[model samples]
Target: MYTPPAFREDDTAVLHALMRAARLCNFVTATAEGLMATPLPLFLDEGEGEFGTLYGHLARANRQWQAPVLGEAMAIFMGPDAYVTPSWYAAKREHGKVVPTWNYVVVQASGPVEFFDDPARLREVVTRLTDLHERPRVEAWAVSDAPEAFVAAQLRGIVGLRMPVTRLMGKRKMSQNRSAEDRAGVAAGLRQGERASDHVVAELVAEEGAS
Candidate 1:
């Protein structure tokens, strides 16, 4: 994350919020064989340690869990992102010096990785994860909704993951480096776009402008 001072996000609260907003994350680890990455849904427990702790699970047969990791594992959480066209920059018309860039928010957490197979702990992790994602639904489901035997069998097919986060890096590139007029143009352009994600980024850009 090569972040300039204007784009760096160091607020712990903001970083945690971004992590929670990211529904999925890319978990990466350096291994003797090579680097391995997995797309996973991770839950962060902010009260666990100085930074926080991450919890997730991987399929029992997934070789990533078996690989020997070096130092710390990284989880990349990407938030709303959009392509910014040069046409959206006022500087493009003024000096024709502006180039296209991207507007996005992301957070990366690094920590020692631990894999466990304890059934009790696995059950608790699964329940917490399920509750986190399901709480907003009208008919929220729970691990207790399923039969004990079935849930137990399902748990057996996966291994638990825990990473006590040691470092957190956050970046929010929302046209903060651009002039006010250029940023306003970007927000207007993105808000009028068809993609829902672009609209989201537009809101973020607008918020940055307000700040």
Candidate 2:
């Protein structure tokens, strides 16, 4: 992540919040054959290590788990992002020097990854992951809701992963580099967009601009 001082996000809590908002992440690793990536859901255990630990699972058929990682594995969590038009910059009117750019938030966590197929650990990981995503629903589902024999068979098809995070990098590019007036223009423009993510980025732009 190429982040300038104005756009860097270092607060641990903020980084975690962003990660949670991104329910799915791209997990990448380097292998002797090549680089491989899988889009999966991972939960953070903030108390596990200096930074935190990541827990998730991948299909047993996924070859990524079979290869030895050359270095560290990285999980990329992307938050709200939007394209910003040069027309939204105040400077565009004054000097016509502004160009289009993107505004977004992202976090990358990297660490050594351990893949395991133990039934007990895999069961726990699956239950926890299910609870995290289902807690908000009126009729939340649980691993126990299914037949024990079926659940056990299902677990056999996947492998659990544990990564004690050694590094965390976060970036929030929310028009922080623009002048206050320019940023305000961007917020106002995005606020009118149809997508829900656009409104979220608008709020972030307004808040960072005010700061």
Candidate 3:
């Protein structure tokens, strides 16, 4: 991530919070064949490793996990993002020098990629993942909800992933490079928009105390 000093997020807690809030992530790995990527809903065990461990699963037949990884894997977690038009900037009117840009938060985690197939480990991973996403629903689902034989059979069709984070890079670009007046204009413009994501970027701008 090419993050300028103004947009860099070095706080570990904040970075972890952003990662946790991201429900889905893209797992990428370099292979002899080429770059392989998969979108998955991953959960983080913040207590697991030095920098926390990521857990997820993919279908057993998915060749991504089977590929020989030449280096550490990468997990990209994206938070709220929005398009920022120059029309929203005060500078655009003041100097007519403004251009379009994007404002967002993202975290990239890199670590050795490990795949597991043991039923017990896969079962634990699946159970934890299920609980994370289903906890918000009124009627939460559980791994044991299915028949023993059926659940066991289903588990055989997927592989478990564990990537202990060795490096974490976080970027938060919310008009930090803009002047105070321009930032305020952007925030006001986002607040008026109907997209919920724009509102999120506004909140982030506020949290950063940028303006």
TM-score of each prediction? 0.98, 0.98, 0.97
Output the lDDT of residue 177, model 3: 82
Give the per-residue lDDT digits (tens) of candidate 3, residues 1-211: 7988998988888889999999899999999999999999999999988789999999999999999999899999999998888998878888898789999889999999899999999999999999988999999999899999999999999999999999999999988888778888888888888999999898877665543
Give the lowest summed-lDDT range of ten residues in model 2. 202-211
Instruction: List candidate 3 segments past 4 Å from native.
Output: none
The 10-residue segment of model 3 with minimum total lDDT is 202-211
List, residue by residue over 33-63, the lDDT tens digit for candidate 1. Answer: 9999999999999999988999999999999
Report every candidate's CA lDDT: 0.95, 0.95, 0.91
> Candidate 1 — worst ten consecutive residues by lDDT sum?
91-100
- Which residue pairs overlap in candidate 2's backbone? none
The predictions' CA RMSDs to the true structure, in order, are: 0.8, 0.7, 1.2
lDDT of model 3 at position 51: 86
Error of 3 at 33 (Å): 0.7
Tens digits of per-residue lDDT for model 2, 84-187: 99999989999999899999999999999999999999999999999999999999999999999999999999999999999999999998888999999999
